[model samples]
Target: MNSEGGKVVCVTGASGYVASWIVKLLLLRGYTVRATVRNPSDTAKTEHLLALEGAKERLKVFKADLLEEFSFEQAIQGCDAVFHTASPVKFTVMDPQTELIDPAVKGTIDVLDTCRKISSVKRVILTSSMAAVLIRQPPLEPNDVVDETFFSDPSVCIESKLWYQLSKTLAENVAWQFAKDNGMDMVVINPGYIIGPLLLPTLNLSVEIIVDMVKGKNPLNCRYYRFVDVRDVALAHVKALESPSANGRYIISGQSVTINHIKETMRELFPDLCIDDMNGEGLMDGINCTMCVDKVKNLGVEFTPLKSSLRDTIISLKEKCLL
Candidate 1:
């Protein structure tokens, strides 16, 4: 786990919004990286990774699937650590279990199982979300200070049909139990709504929300939203892997603001664009909660400002002609 030398590591879902950033940072840090993607031959999905600074000599892309048993064996075979960042993030699906829940929960198990069999693998950093820690049966009190100690209630999530939250909650829970039973060294990062520059031409859910708003569409149903920079989240994963003192889950969030606050900022930054006003009551209209990041800060993580993050997002969108 030392920060020195060119240690070999594997990153799952390497072409994703956040995972791509993780891969870039890892390569810059001089680590020999084995990146796994569903289809390595797809240039559109992998060109960004293949063009990184040290990619030609230090990066290798492997083909893997979440549901297929032992599919990650080749990618994780000789790595010193694994970063499991692959998961289904759809909001609407005909079959929640088959589309969202099964892939997330089963995907996590398959990655960990591969790591367990690899004698050279020493640690794992799993990417979870605040959705797993924020949702509850009875909504949190207005004064509640949420942290890693809080967990989303499965019964409540299922009753409300919050399949995305339920999937994250279940997947993270399963990972902890598996790690404990098998005596594995593991760390989990629960990040908020991630936003920043895009590495790929395609849009992700978070960035797509911003694009929708810029085009005069109101996509969010919640009154309060949390934000974090994708770079900060990626740095936290590397820090967690290198620091031996790190343990348990860390909540990585930069800020929590009202929907109106975000809209105002967007308006100021992009005066030329026509941004729509959100109408009707929101899902979190009156619920007030705070996410504490003291744990992540302890690992030497400094978050990017909200305004700066949003400004960079718009610029990246424009560069890709998405705005």
Candidate 2:
């Protein structure tokens, strides 16, 4: 194990699919990690985290709720760095404001506020989604190449009822403002659709899409699909924290392909699995945009190939009996 010189860090939403990987990587890199989950008593949510290598000696699980103010204080205190990955991710909800926006915006502010109070905390790495970069007003052109400069338009999100996208955009916006106002060192990682092996027994929304597709269910409605491995996303967070020069927002994406391309690749890899195509019914049939990963690559992240990611995802699902 490469010693981090007794560096201690805090990761909020530690039980989550992406955050779980982050905790595992941090622990493996010899960093003492304080992982905060909603319920430490819930074995289902925390067992995987506890089971990771080096977890017993270097990992501590704390209970934290996003909506509860000052709940993250104890978990973040005395930490050298903080990774704020806790956010509400509901694509469709009856009350978008209460179910999505409130938790996302309030939870970010609460975490940052706690970090600001702690003098030991030097840097913060926030996990924002591609949703904040993809959806925009007037819509992106087919030839548009999206980079860190692009941001999802709030007006378009509100008018189109893109609640999840709006929540991430608003939360990230608030985080930047709060950090600048308080002179905090903050780096944001905007990852594409996160897919790969599951550390938790449960399935996240991104992995669930692949599982649904394998079961002959068509869950994809977008013409363009962008994906990155969960492990890569986790590594990006660590890299952002370790690299002193890492600043601003970095877009971490692996592959950009079409729905048909995904279907073909799956069929080629797992011919036995019953995978169905969308039959050219995608919402944005002809519209396509590229996600620029040049910024993240500069962080020394060699992205895991999408084919390998898809294969491992299927293998993991089969092992978990979710396929």
Candidate 3:
């Protein structure tokens, strides 16, 4: 272990889709991780994390709840950094308030509450989404490419019935306000539609897009969206932690492609899959991606290419027998 180089850090939701990769990289980089999960004894939920390289020597797991105040205090005690990545992610739930908004917004406040009590903590890295920054509805012009400065209009999100995006926007808004008011050192990584090799066997909404594509779902190839690789997203979190200048929000993304473009790549890679291609010429007024990634690039983080991200996602799904 690089004890001199490593710092003890706490990661909330360590078994999560993106958080798993963050914990893996932290362990790989010699950082001792204090990981929090809903149920520590659930082997199926934590086995992938336990199998990582330095987990035995340096990783510790604890139970914490997003709603319970001070639930993270024990796990965060004495840690140098905290990565608060826990949030409920159901979009089609019967109750958006209980399933999405409360968890997203209130959970952030709960974590910040813990941070305020932990004097040993120096910096916090938040896993925010592009939804916090980009307006989903579009008659977007080419110049609509956004950066950290852009914030999605919460009203617009609600008007469009995009509960998930609104949840993220509100949650991130709370985080930024709390951080500023309390003088907390924080950085936000707003990633595009995240997709890559998931460490956990559980399905992620982003990876579901890949599965839908492989199964030749027509709607999957009917629109355009921006995407970033999960591996790149993980590295960005580490970079934000280590880089002194990485203070504000940074957008991490790779090239944006139409769904048709993605389907073409999938067709070439998995020739046996039944797939159809559409030009998607008029799809949402050519809104490939309404964001820019130059800010994150300035931090020396390179995103994985779109093709590679898709290919890896497919391979992972096949390995799990999900495709």
TM-score of each: 0.96, 0.96, 0.93
Q: How good is model 3 by TM-score?
A: 0.93
Supply the global lDDT for candidate 2: 0.88
Ranking by lDDT: 1, 2, 3
- Segments in model 1 whose C-alpha atoms lie over 4 Å from true places: 278-283
Per-candidate local distance difference test:
0.90, 0.88, 0.83
Worst 10 residues of 1 by lDDT: 278-287
TM-score ranking, best first: 1, 2, 3
Q: For candidate 1, give the lDDT of residue 196.
A: 97
Model 3 deviation from native, Cα RMSD in Å: 2.3
Q: State which candidate, 2 or 3, has the greater TM-score.
A: 2
**What number of clashing residue pairs does each candidate have, in the order they appear?**
0, 0, 0
Candidate RMSDs in Å, in order, are 1.4, 1.7, 2.3
Across residues 1-323, which tens digit of lDDT does each residue of candidate 2 receive? 12358899999999999999999999989899999999999999999999999999999999999999999999898999999999977787999989999999999999999999999999999999888887876788867888999988888889888899899999999999999999999999999888999999987898998887676555766666778999999999999999989999999876668766777888999898878654564365533677788999999899898889999999998899888
